[model samples]
Target: MSAGNIRLYSYWRSSAAYRVRIALNLKGLPFETMPVHLLQDGGQQHTPEFNDLNPQELVPVLMHGNRILRQSMSIIEYLDETWPTPPLMPATARERQRVRAIAQMIACDIHPLNNLRVLQFMDKTWNVPQAERDTWTRHWIKVGLDAVEDTLCDNPSTGDFCDGEQPTLADCCLVPQVFNAERFGVDMAPYRTIRRIVQNCLAMDEFKAARPENQPDAPAPGGN
Candidate 1:
């Protein structure tokens, strides 16, 4: 509602937070970012103030007017509903469903299993070794990307981007997942379609600006 006062609780490397950033930039909206260091002192998201804002203790809680939106995809949908310029979903019902399915193939099917908290739990609580953790991350990411490649290869609707020539919600979700995959040392040569799509999106200013390394709070080149 309000113009310049929008605030985003974010971590530079967070894939979920990265999705919301891309959506906001695509909508051409101005918002301030509040960096939440997810690893500092056991994660600032767990602090009382942030917990009150979002009990889930996640980065990327968007504050617009009095509304606090949680969950990356939900926030992106809300932005689409509120702003509606360069629509992220297709006009037809079937097309919209297809777009959402592609987006979920990454957001729902891939990201959650390898999120930071999940890995932390596996390492700390379960005592899983680092090699196994890398294996876990790579496994889920590859499975999701394989599904994406199959879906896009079959669906004629898929153009340069996930749904069409223009970047859609699916592209928003896909790019970040690709970034995560690279981070985990996953071999992406198997998913040729996904790799091509990610390359296309990377060339766009909107997606380029939303990259984790491009964020103001991003860690230095090799630093975590």
Candidate 2:
């Protein structure tokens, strides 16, 4: 682990890991990726070896030499601090707070109800049918995105990104959530602001390269 060397434990389709990939690419930091197959062999995240890295049994665990970081939001903040040339937070504290709030709307409120384990629990415990599980995921994502669309569309502060003219931590959180929403068949026609912002993000090489489908460990065509 030399200087600037980072190892990220990631799953190709993980929205959290996708966020970190954008942060790393935006900061112009290069890192090695270790694919953690979430569905293979009964979930590698639950294994003892991986558990040593993150007791929470989650992906997007970052290793920088002796130091280990967890949580996509925390890791992105650390990256922004360590590599500040391309600042992720806005200059003013108030703007930064707004940016963080938008980011958390997706990360905390929308995502928790739709994560793999939650869906799995619904299936394994309550015997929820696949169609109903999809409905559950779509409901949360739509509700969350509706609020986010309102905030961004109604606010004067929003620029090409979530806050100001520059890309911030909020954009990093946003694109991935949008991707997940589309995958689950949530209609995007109503979210004009989000669609515009995501279009701007996808135009940049940093964001394009961070897409889940572009990851090395992503499933091949036809879902492998």
Candidate 3:
């Protein structure tokens, strides 16, 4: 599909959506943003219009020409395959597996536990308090990040980025998770490698542009 026809339906603070944004920016692809506010109007994602687009009702849906794509990881992989310059996946199979492992550890294991819906469910279904919910969020993030830190630390493949000097799919996943962890009050003092890599990633123009605060739908600094 042509660059002009690329459109992304994204939420400002959704880590999954953030992952796709990072990948698109890193690939230097120009895409239109269709903001879907997760908290407004009881979530625009729950509307019939959006439900038809994605039964899962998640953001970071990509419309490339007439094709519809959901799931941030899948969309990012599609972008990598469709636009190969500055490839996101590594060249070797083993290296690719390592990247995917790290990506999935965050995307599948860490992120899902603390996703908005899951947190909302905990609040509504179980009447979980905000402080308790935050504690819950922090616990899982620490658990997952602890494993990630172990994986990244002392690994030869770990460079300035997660797997190599150049940012890969793993970096796209890591940066957003770190953002969420920080937002939820997870302590970062223990994860030196993650902090180092995240600092390296955020210093880049692409990663900076894709940050949650930079998104059009993001709330103003002092505004709710």
Candidate 4:
């Protein structure tokens, strides 16, 4: 498969979109990124055109050939299956399960509580103060990453990256969550294993290119 006509609807700072970007880059796939600003004009994703593309109105929607793919993890798996070189998954089924577990710990358990939509709802629906929301975000992030740190440290399978010295689906998910955590001032000192893995990941051009700041839609430095 040539991975022909690939396009991604993304937001620069969206962790979900960031994961997909990493997967695409790791697979050496060239893609067109269609920016969907989640905060501008009450969210470009809510627009009629975008709604037709994905009723969930979430970013990280991937269009490959004529197929429409939603959800960051699914998109990454699709890419991995479609393009197997530089495989992002381990060889055995059990190892793949471990990778998915780590990925979901962040994507499913941690991210939902602090995603922009949830924070916005807290502010608009209940009038949660910004400082309080920041606290809430930091709390959940700490709780989640604390478990992730233990998971990585305890598992002998863990190597330079999330699994076996190469960036896996787990690393794709982990780095973005760590980015959000750092942006909100969550302490990273406690997650030594995760910090080490993320450092290893960022050293790679694929991961560097997928950073939020490297995205075209990212706000100008010191301008946002």
- Give the Cα error of residue 141 in candidate 4, in Å: 0.3
For 1-224, candidate 1 gives per-residue lDDT tens digits of 44567899999999999988888888888889899999998899999999999999998899998888999888999889988887887899998899889888888989999998999999999999999999999999888888899999857898888888888888889989989999899888888888888899899888888899988898889898
Superior by lDDT: candidate 2 or candidate 3:
3
Model 3 misses residue 168 by how many Å? 0.4
Question: What lDDT is reached at residue 208 by model 4?
Answer: 98
Query: Which portions of model 1 show Cα errors greater than 4 Å?
Result: none
**What TM-score would each prediction reach against the true structure?**
0.97, 0.98, 0.98, 0.98
- What's the lDDT for candidate 3? 0.93
Tell me model 4's lDDT, rounded to 2 decimals: 0.94
Question: How displaced is residue 201 in candidate 2, in Å?
Answer: 0.3
lDDT of each: 0.89, 0.93, 0.93, 0.94
Tell me the tens digit of each residue's lDDT in model 3 across 66-173.
Answer: 899999998999999999988999999999999999999999999999988999999999999999999999999999999999999999999999998999999999
> Which runs in model 3 stand beyond 4 Å of their true positions?
none
lDDT of 1: 0.89
Candidate 4 error regions (>4 Å):
none
lDDT of 2 by residue, 30-137 (tens): 999999999899999999999999999999999987789999999999988888878999998899899999999999999889999899899999999999999999
- Clash numbers, per candidate: 0, 0, 0, 0
- 177: Cα error in model 4, Å: 0.5
